[model samples]
Target: MAKIAYILLCHKGPEAIIGQAEMLTAAGDYIAIHFDGRAKPEDFQQIKAALADNPNVTFARKRIKCGWGEWSLVQATLLAVEAAVQAFPRATHFYMLSGDCAAIKSARYAHDFLDAEDVDYIESFDYFDSDWIKTGMKEERLIYRHFFNERKHKWLFDTSFHLQQRFGLKRDIPHDIQVQIGSQWWCLRRRTVEWILDFTRKRRDVMRFFRTTWIPDETFFQTVVRHLVPDSEIRTRTLTFLMFTEYGMPQTFYNDHYDLLLGQDFLFARKISPEAIELKQRLGALYSNDKAEFKISNEGTSLFKFLTGRGRIGRRFASRFWETESTLGRQRELMIVICKKWHVAKRLLEQIRQVTNVPAIEYLFNEEHTDLPDLGGIQTSLGKRTRHRRALMRMLFDYYETDQMIVCMDPSALDLLQDFASDRSTTRMLEVQCVFSDEYLIGHAMRVGLAGEQTSAETLERLLPTIRGDMTFESDKIRDAEFEHHYIINEARDAEENAAPLSNFLDISHDKARQIAQSDHLFAD
Candidate 1:
């Protein structure tokens, strides 16, 4: 068995962090935690005392005053990494995590997964090569120096930075070093961690250069690690899931995020708050039960990996439209439109009907008089919209009795749905939509058709061409859109108003109901 070390960077959520530590603890496995220096002494002491009895747990002797998008964040992480390395000399791999993160898999599973790999699990992309430069800080993050966390002479720093930018005076990136950026969380092998420490020691100038850069934590380790390893040795994916808002705020996970969390291939998920006590308890119980039943077997391991599209094999296993009682009137309107655009509607119906091997395909409508054209294998039920939706979902959960249910209405998500169906290693409930484009015609259709929003006939006409194009269900575009949509939905649901609906309808939360309501339709005239 290989020893694993976890370096947890924490400021809050002490109980959750402690739970995480306890879950990952085993003989030869160790944990090192560094509480933010800004945190109260009592808070740190409380977390420390909780793990005092555990011999495998240790705390960093040096804690940096960490702040978001500051050098301190990287400093604190390095401190924890160094402490863990010193404390657990035999550790084969180190997993970097946050205070809010929880392990979704068992320690044995994680160990087996890593033991089968000779590569580092770190998400890295060249700074200039990725969309990060376009979507992220761009020149502001790299060209000018930032003193964002500096309290003293803050005005002076801002003035100086502005003057530098105004005069085209910029800090020169090291000529020999290629800059890379990625998600800050990573799982690195022992040699890689040691190399990073040694690299920093010998390259003090590099360290000093990044000190003034924005969010250096996301880039520093990535640039260093990629530079040291061969391309084949690097796997550009983190084994953790982090949800960020459009404004770049980290999302707090709630009970509703449970299904999505379990569906992902990641070993851990982050930003879980203390308020999610129920979720925390559920996760604890889940990992405990999984760990108990876990046994390393060779049957179908390779095939399972191929089917799921994940690098490591673990255990071999195993939504609502509309709100309103005037659904009949709404259905009449939709039917008239469907009749008008019969070609597109026919294609969509055929595409859905052709989808085979699914346990059952059911459509629930609130209107008793809905005369929707019947498609084979799709069961339709009529009742009050919300009531029908809830009952149907419950029935589907009971009938399938497994996690591999893919519930989607749009034909655009067909490719993604097929992917889910092929992967039997895990159970997932997939809700397909044009999550990439808020202005996508299908999104507008969903808003008006599903959410009961009012729209003009002219808008519907303009949306026809786009809907026809979307019916093809371009796999690449759908995948990208789904990723972006998940990001926004995760963020929005963290807010109070959105939280309620998110809890009630977990899959619908990703559509960002409020944002969709307010968004301008491109086809609207």
Candidate 2:
């Protein structure tokens, strides 16, 4: 059995710690607890009692009080890691956690999973030039000065450039990863832990460098880890959805909503209110079909309860997300109908006139186009109106061929276009509505007096930079991947470009972008 140690850090984490402990217990790994030094004595007593029975549990004596954006948080973590390594020397892996975090998968499985990949397991860090102010970060000059003063570090400029490279990445990737700073909580191989702790211990300058920033905790460890293991698949982020309500932030504990606990992929998350917790649990269960458990711990709590509860919940939820067939049974129905009016256009335009035919020229124009007809069905016309339609048809037919044009017409016109294109060329012009495209938004805005005609075009020109800005946030390696994902010119490129012209959409304002970045609604799952 591979030994592992789980580290929990918190100011005053609630029952969720119990669930985490249970998770680790079921995984059969040892766990250690580190409470922020500022926690009340009574709270510490309660915590110690909760964890007392677990043989693997060891509560830290050295506690450091941490506040958001303070360096103390990172110090607390590093302290715990030092303790854990000494206490569980045989452990193969280390997963750091917060009191509010819950395990969505078996804690033991994480150690087992280490065998599948050779990643270093640091969360991704990307640049954020535009949202720098939004996230409450200091300007470049201040950040640079602070680090230089704190450690006299020479590499601040290089790190800044590295971050810039990530922000401007342009690629056509379909994955759900965004570059940002690393999270405090993470899972690292024991080898990595040993190396980082050693490096920081010998380099007091590096420690001082980390102490200068608002949340230097994220970057300090990330920077050091990246240096130590440059080529590892540092994920930099997980697929957890976070939400902060309009009122006070949510509470961290609850008992009835066990199903919510199982739906998460991460072992834990920031706190949620009791009301929000209920909703999150219920909604998660309804949509994802996962179950969750809640627990609490202090000094007395054992790691066993955390691991065991998590393992039980994870097994059930894993079967739902991974093993079971989907319960939502409906799928899209595509209807294909073959109609014959193949030769109608050719026959009407006859250079080889047949005597039995009707007045082909007049029939082309006299016919009422209640609905747009299929390309194969429309009679060839020489009148001005028919000529214009033909011009549009030629543009479309080049790509689709006569029989292939899938023009989406309301009920009546579908057959006409289909029939008309059947004979002339194999290419068919597909009919589609432009409602969702920027063109519709622009024109509708103008019609409703919300914008002038040029307003939409001007808005688009302005919005391009912001879109370009947001696209810049990427890790150094991921920036390269982004370039590859977005700019690839293929058959789909022409279709996508022609479909939505930015000239019709508003340039997203800075205010709007900040709102999007900060609003829980924007980030909500």
Full-model lDDT for every candidate: 0.59, 0.44
Q: What is the TM-score (0 to 1) of candidate 1? A: 0.54
Instruction: Give stretches of model 2 more than 4 Å off.
Output: 1-3, 13-19, 126-134, 138-180, 239-525
lDDT of 1 at 205: 82
Give the TM-scores of the predictions, in the order they appear.
0.54, 0.42
RMSD of each: 17.7, 25.2
Maximum-lDDT candidate = 1
